[model samples]
Target: MKHQHCRKAGNVLMIVGLVVMVSSIIFSVLNQLPSIQMPALLAQGAILGIFIGALLWLAGARVSGRERIEDRYFWHRHYDERCRRTPHH
Candidate 1:
C-alpha cells in the first residue's frame, strides 16, 4: 500500500524517531523523583535523543509529505505558520 501522508520511508523513520525522543523526555521527567538518580549519562543520552528527534522532525518537515510539490507547499505553509506561533530556538 502507498502512504498518503509521508512520501518517503525516511520521513516515516524520522517521525518514529521523533516519537521515541518525545516519549523518552516524558518518561525521564515523570520518573524524576528523590529516589531516581537517573544517571547523568542516561539523562544526557535522553537529551541527545531529543535533539536527534528535533533534527529529524525538522528534516521531515522540510522534505516529506504529499505527492505533488504543490501539496507539500500547502502543508508547508501551514507548518510554517504553526512554527511561527511556537517558541523556537
Candidate 2:
C-alpha cells in the first residue's frame, strides 16, 4: 500500500521531470534561433546536453525484473560486449 504509492509517485515525478527538462531544451533552442546566433548555438547545445542527462537520470529510475535497464544501457554493455569483457583496470 504505502510502498506502492511511493513507487507510483516516483514514477510520476521521473516522467514529469524528464518532460520538463526536454521541453526546456526545446524552448531554449527555439528562442535562440534568431539573434545572438553563436551564443545561441552554445546555449542550445548546453540545453540539449542537460536534456539528455535528465532523460538518462529518468532511465536510471526504471526497474526491470528487479534490475535497472540503465545498468546495461548506461554502461554501454548491451551494445558493446567488449566493454563488458574488459576489466575495470
Write candidate 2's Cα lDDT for 1-89 as tens digits: 47676567557656666776776676676666785455656676667766675764465365212135556676686457676776554
Worst 10 residues of 1 by lDDT: 59-68
All candidates: TM-score: 0.53, 0.45
Which residue pairs clash within candidate 1? none
lDDT of 1 by residue, 26-89 (tens): 7568557767766778877777878788777666655565235666677666667663556445
Model 1 / residue 33 / CA error / Å: 1.4
lDDT of 1: 0.68
In candidate 2, stretches whose alpha carbon ends up further than 4 angstroms from where it belongs are: 35-84
Quote model 2's TM-score.
0.45
Off by over 4 Å in 1: 1-6, 65-89
| RMSD in Å for all candidates | 8.0, 7.1
Q: All models: lDDT?
A: 0.68, 0.61
